[model samples]
Target: MTNQIYPCLWFDGQAQAAAKFYCSIFKNSKITADNQMVVTFELNGKKFMGLNGGPHFKFNEAVSFVVDCDTQEEIDNYWSKLTADGGSEGTCGWLKDKFGVSWQIVPTVLPKLLSNPDKAQNVMQAYMKMKKFDIRELENA
Candidate 1:
């Protein structure tokens, strides 16, 4: 076994629910294990463990999962699923799920644009006005 530490999220008695919700959003995703206290799942090939710690602590924006999508459809799909059931939307394609876990549903081209010296400012301008990212607009800008 490798010594890498997979993210272990703390949920308020909703570990299973969170795991199921995450698995439903991504292709090739599934819950690998589950019990009364913990649920394990893979989201787009990444492993994560969720704990039903009974409302002791909550998720915050200090840490977040960034989904780099190749197309706008993928971004929209993830945004929709992750924001379901009392999740709140934030600026710049960021959102917090019902369990308060932060997510950035960003396009793959976003980093390219931001890294491009020629179009970086324009891309930033376009992104500044948006809630969910518009990949086409970012490309055009």
Candidate 2:
């Protein structure tokens, strides 16, 4: 037997809206099921459930979804879409979606760049000043 684990996001009566919004952003994503209380969706083939769990709890930076992008365009796309509407940007490529869910849009090469002790500090410094990750700048760093 195998176990499949997935994340369930709590929403304030906006499960359906949030699910639709997310589906619109990622390619090959869709809402699998929806109801007054819950909405199940798949983003890029990963399953997730959103519950209209009320205002008892809210999303914070303690937990965040990380999107590792291969290119500057990919990072820009996610950063722009996720920060649209009522969403706000945070330091170091972190941003809160309109639903207040925190997400990190980062370049896939970030780990590789940071792995080198010689260039790690420079790369970190460069990214520290960036809201959206710039792949070229990191490569240059």
In terms of TM-score, the best-performing candidate is: 2
What range of 10 consecutive residues in model 2 has the weakest lDDT sum? 1-10
Report, for every candidate in turn, its global Cα lDDT versus the true structure. Answer: 0.91, 0.94
Q: Would you estimate the TM-scores of all the predictions?
A: 0.94, 0.95
The residue-by-residue lDDT of candidate 2 on 1-141, one tens digit each, is 269899999999999999999999999899999889999999999999999999999999999999989988899899999999999999899999999999999888999999999999999999999888888988898
How well is each residue in 21-115 modelled by candidate 1, as lDDT tens digits?
A: 88888889999999999999998888999988887787889999999899999988888888999999999999998889999989988888999
Give the residue spans of candidate 1 off by over 4 A: none
lDDT value for model 1: 0.91
